[model samples]
Target: MKAILPGSAADTDKPVVLGEAAEPEPAADEAVVAVEAYSVNRGETFQLDGGLERRWAGWRPGKDVAGTVIRAAADGTGPAAGTRVVAHPPAYGWAERVAVPTASLAELPDSLDAVTAAALPLAGITALRLLRAAGPLAGRRVLLTGASGGVGHYLTELAAASGAEITAVTATAERGARLLPLGAVELITSVDEAQGPYDVVFESVGGASLPAALAQLASGGQLVWFGQASREPVALNFFDFFKGPNQARITHFDYTTSDTTYGQDLTALVRLVAAGRLHPEIGSVRDWSRTADIITDLRGRNIRGNAVLTVG
Candidate 1:
């Protein structure tokens, strides 16, 4: 079996390699999936490029995968053999096959292709959960910072459907262009340009962006901080809160820590895609052999949305 793994720490350009791996062994509550396609996420690029340190020597770098069940769980808890599915494995998903827990697996409809299904797990689930955190979007003003990635694409469409007015912040107008049709009322390059008094703020690009978003928070608004793509420390003064409406709050988010089950949320997203209600923006699709190149593109921000790689 072959899987994409982190290369030598000194290798800056090629940070990952399609190397040999042990065949998957499913637990009683897990199924063996024959991976058809997998998507690379922005966070995985950090782990691969050494931007985020690996806690162990042999850490693997994949999370979102779509495939067919090759073996059902011994306990019969998940899809049977030959079922098409999208899954979020605990880890080690960048392989020909992976062992996925039943709780993280969702049967895919025949209408949904593997490439699109592969794009859904991590980013889609995160966006879904973020929207859940925002709660009751109808008639609310929502501000989304760093609104051009996979999560952003999903979040924009999801929030807009809930009747929330969205102001998306991107690094450039061209980078933010696609978000317009997805339901963003306006796009701004900097968070500082956002109109204040938003009911909910989805903040991902941290740094000065954090405080800038806080300044726009409305009375009792909720600002969810998810990622720090800027990789800079956020310095906040006590008076920064006074710039916004009183009692505004900021909540840090981690999708893994969310109460929702992966299978449950993934199924909701898959159903939307099947019904033409949700669209997964696939920026790059290529053979899995080019996985390293895709990772490089993601790190460079050259690839928009999710990047999917097909397995032979």
Candidate 2:
């Protein structure tokens, strides 16, 4: 087996060095996947920067994976060997092969390829949970900030399918145009000029945009804060909460939880992909050996959609 190793936070140049390692065998409750493809998330950069901490506390940098089960636990409660599946691995997913608990794996529909399936887990789950927290999306005037990235694209599609009228905010005209076919009812390049008073505001970009998003929400509306793309601190006014005639709700999303919800989310995503409701827009696909360059491209925000590394 081959894997990428990161020594420390300061060593940014090609942090993922390919090296041969022994193939992992599944534990009693684990399964070994022959990784076919994996998607990169923005948080991977934070992990590289030593900003985001990992559950396993090691520095291998891949998270969402779709692949075939090469070996399963003896109990057979997991996917059978040779079954195609996607999983939210315990650690971030940067590897040629991974050993994960069977609970993390979700069966992929025949219509969804490993590459696209790889794009679903983290981003898809976050979108589902965000929309659920926002309540029934039907007929709601929804505002999506930073609606051009991985999670943003999925959020847009999911919200649209639920019959929400979506207004998407992007940083550039080019990115804004990309959202037109993705079900964005309106595109606003400048947040300041955005006509809102939306029923729900999905805030993926934080910092100045957080307060801006909150301002756009209609009284009694809800705001779901998911990411901090700007990486800036957000300021809020306490008096605004009580002074407003209508009630307002603010919620933050965290996807780190039990494997059951993770599996359910991926399964729903696979079904959406099969039904032509969710199509993952991939910005770039690179060979496994070019992991460092992929991370650099992602960090620069030069890539759009979810970036996948084809391991095969």
Candidate 3:
């Protein structure tokens, strides 16, 4: 089968390619999915495109996948064989087929298609986890960064549904327009421009934006740091928090290490999609082999939302 592998290091323009690899076998508690499609993530681009050293240069490189289960878990845990499911592979998912833990598999309802289901796993799970980390969002003042992103879009809608007074931040006013109905009470181009005293901040963009978000936190507020799309390190003085007027709680959430149960969150997200309440903003639904172009565009922040790749 063909899988997406890291591009040649000597080449600067292209950053990914389709490479041939043997099919994988499922473990006792895992299922092998015949991948129909998958979504390209910003973090995946960062990890593959010369950002991290590659010992296995020609290995698979996708995180989310949706397809029919060709092989059921040996333990008889998850869905039976032939069940349509969406999964978040720990790594190496960009292949004709991939194996994922049964606990992380979510059965898709007949209402949802593979293209949309493929876009949900990583981004949806992250959004759900962030909301959980931030505590109850209802009746709270929330400020969200990267409002137009894949996770950002889901976060905005979910937070809004919780009755939080949301202030969304985007890079441009044009992109801010779509976020308004998604639960954003007010829209701004940057975190520094938002009103202070927010009860919670769903921060994904780090670097300069991190300091501005921290400064705006209300007393006893929680700042959930997830992704640093800015690709910049975050640093600040002790006085900014220890002696600051509003002492906010700063928390970091990593999906791989976070205590949030994968099956639980994934099931909830799938339900939302089936109910027509959750609309995944899918962009650039293209061939999987075009991954090189997708990587280049994501690193440039040119792709506004999640880019879905149809696999077969």
Candidate 4:
């Protein structure tokens, strides 16, 4: 099996290196999945760049994966061998195969091909969980920043289906076109251009966008901050919070919060895609070997949708 790991010398040209790894075997409650494709997240780049933390030697990267079951659970409790499945592996999913517990598996049907299934788990589940926390957004005005990314795109469609009025913010006109059909009532290239007084904001871009989003919230509105794509620390003053007539609610959401509901929400997302109600927008698809370039694009915010790396 092959996997991605941090390069031995951080000062070298490449921060990540690809090499052979030991194949994993299923534990009694786990199965070995043959990874067909996987998506990239900004968080992974941070780890690879040493921005988030120190990386140990030979530590694997990646989290979201879509593939087929090659080995069934030894306990006979998971999907049988050959079942198509998507999984949020216990880290190190950049490899060709991952040993995953049944609890983390979401069975994918033929209607949902592995290529698309591979792109949904992490972003889709995060979107579902964010909307779930917003609590009945129907008829409410919502602002979604970074609306072209994986989580943003999924959040736009999901929120629209729930009847919320959506104002989506992205970085390019071509990217803006990709969001409209998903039901964004208004699309802008920058958060400064969006008309708000929004009931909720799913904010991904940090720095000024955060304060800009905070300034637009309706009384008692909520802002959900998830990512700092802008690469700047969040800086807001008293006036930013007190400028509004009424108080606004701001909360941070990440994938780990829904530990118990991870599989269930992920399964629901798969079913939604299978039913054609939700679409996982894939921004880029490349052979797994090009992972280095893929990571570069992902870190530069060049990908318009979920970026997938296909395993041969």
Task: Name the best candidate (by TM-score).
Answer: 1
Indicate the worst ten consecutive residues by lDDT in candidate 4: 6-15
Tell me the tens digit of each residue's lDDT in model 1 across 224-308.
9999988787888887677657899989788998777999999999999999999888899999999888877877778778899
Q: Which should have the higher TM-score, number 2 or number 4?
A: 4
Query: Which is superior by TM-score, 1 or 2?
Result: 1
- Candidates, ranked, TM-score: 1, 3, 4, 2
Report every candidate's CA lDDT. 0.90, 0.81, 0.84, 0.84
User: Residue 193 error for model 1, in Å?
Assistant: 1.7
Evaluated against the true structure, the overall lDDT of model 1 is: 0.90
TM match of model 1 to true structure: 0.97
In the order shown, what is each candidate's alpha-carbon RMSD? 1.2, 2.0, 1.8, 1.8
Error of 2 at 29 (Å): 2.3
With a 3 Å backbone cut-off (N, CA, C), the pairs that clash in candidate 1 are none
Q: What is the Cα-based TM-score of model 3?
A: 0.94
lDDT of 2 by residue, 1-312 (tens): 687776557877765677766666667888888899998888877777677775464447767998999888776778889899999886646677888777777998787888889888888888888877788989989999988888889989888989999999888878667677888899887668778788998887888888877877788898888888877888877786566526877887776743346777778888888988888888888887887888888777788788898986
Error of 2 at 146 (Å): 1.2
Every model's TM-score? 0.97, 0.93, 0.94, 0.94
Output the TM-score of candidate 2.
0.93
